[model samples]
Target: MRVLVIGGTGFIGQHLVACLVRAGHAVHVPTRRYQKGRNLLVFPTLTLFEADVHDDAVLERLLSETDAVVNLVGVLHSKPGRPYGIEFERAHVELPRRIAAACRKIGVRRLLHVSALGADAQGPSGYQRSKAAGEEAVRAEFSTYSEGALTIFRPSVVFGREDNFMNLFARLARWLPVIPLAGAGARLQPVYVRDVAAAMANALENSQTYGKTYTVAGVSQYTLAELARLAAKWSGRPRPVLPVPHFVGYAQALLFEFLPGRPLMSRDNLDSLKVDNVSDEAMAPELGVVPTPLESVAPSYLRGGKPDRGPVH
Candidate 1:
């Protein structure tokens, strides 16, 4: 299979690309900057195209020789708005719509879209709402095409060695004496990055996954405070977590929002944490994958051992 992967340069993307490559699929990854994809260059099956993926012409050209498309493009923070902010609309909503359109136009039928676990149309945060809108756009756009198939994957917070979730907490625990956290009681099922990558690859080959929405989660669930504590424990620097009140959490997020670059936490993030990120229905088993536990995988990387880059098989 010839797969065109948008947003294939990030943490999850790298793992997914490696899986696809190992499976002998020719993968095309487009990036605005080639230097960002240096790690992916080692894969012989991957060809990195340095271009703006949002451009219609560029996207169509990439889709021309592709058998399927994987849309992993997502944004964590955005300027606040009603339906969604401009950045969220562009990345979460507009981008999926564009990808679906491009895939249909170029005669590509299969699309595997990565959405968030807590995404809902009436969700509290702009991120969740925008993600819901993105799912809608893909479904609507592909509904008309008889040959088109859209597989949407909604995974809980994904964690691995290169992940921003556990690693961020681990780093904080290592450096800081005490951890001041928000959404301490919020529950989340942290799936391993490798499991997610495997699920995406499996969906691409398995026709049963088409036109279905799958919720990919880990074997166990944990609270935000518990996750922080686990991170600290794994990193061998267990710190006391002080869970702040909702108002105080929002205030802390507001302060971080003004900080340079991406905020450590934003009010929108707090809004997302309002909902528990656990799945009622398990999708990994359907994809022939037994979900990896966070405890089994995180300790290998966080505790200074060789990172587990093993395939789901």
Candidate 2:
């Protein structure tokens, strides 16, 4: 299979590209920027296509040479120039809209999309709502294409050596004596990166999974506070977890959203946390892929973990 992976330069995208190539698929990773050399290099089976995916002409041309498309584009944070609509809606919703249209135009049928676990089409937060909208577009437009060929996988917070969630927290825990908390009671099922890549690879290879939406999560669930404790312990910081009330957290989010750097926590993220980031029981038997536990994979990338298998050496 010839697979065109959008957002292949990203964290999960990197893993997914490798997985697809290992599975005997010819992979093409398209990027917008053309740096002389990148920090991470693509595999031999992987080809690089340099173009802005948001550009309809470019994406359409790229689709011409591919049999299937896997969309891995998403952003958790928004900035002045890059709003949620551009980051999430365009990448999530509108890109799918265009992809579906292009696929129809080019006669490319198969597609596998990565959607977050808590996505709700009618939800309040921009992130969830946009993801849900994207899924909706794919189902409505591409479900019947080539007789029901489209697979959507909703995953919880994916953790691995290169994950942003755990890595950022670990970096913070390393320097800070105390960590601020928002929505401490919020729960998350931290799935592994390789597991997600495997799921994507499986979906792309198996035609039986088409037109199905699968929810993937870790073996166990943990609250935000518990996640903090685990991060502190794993990162070897053991800092005090400072609980910030909802109001306070929101206030801080408001300020940080406008700040130069990425916000540690944003109001939209807090709102997203209001909903549990775990798989629903209904989706359990439907998809039928048992998720790998965080405990099994955390040490592989945790700070001061087993030698040659963690964030630190």
Q: Which candidate gets the maximum TM-score versus the true structure?
A: 1
Weakest 10 consecutive residues of candidate 1 by summed lDDT: 304-313
Mind giving the per-residue lDDT tens digits that candidate 2 earns over 1-313?
8999887778778777777777788988888874621533546677875788778898889999999998888888643222345677667888888888788778888888888898886665778888888888987887556643788888889888767787777787888889888888888888877777777777786766877888878888889888887877887777778888889999999988888787877788887888778764433443435676676666556775553232110
User: Candidate 1 lDDT, tens digit per residue, 230-276?
Assistant: 89998999998989888999998899999898998889999999999
Indicate the residue-level lDDT of 188 in model 1.
94
Query: Listing every candidate in turn, what is its Cα RMSD in Å to the true structure after a full C-alpha superposition?
Result: 1.5, 3.3
Candidate 1 local distance difference test against the native: 0.89
Q: In candidate 1, which residue ranges exceed 4 Å CA deviation?
A: 309-313
Per-prediction TM-score to the true structure, in the order listed: 0.97, 0.90
lDDT of each: 0.89, 0.77
Pairs with steric clashes in candidate 1: none
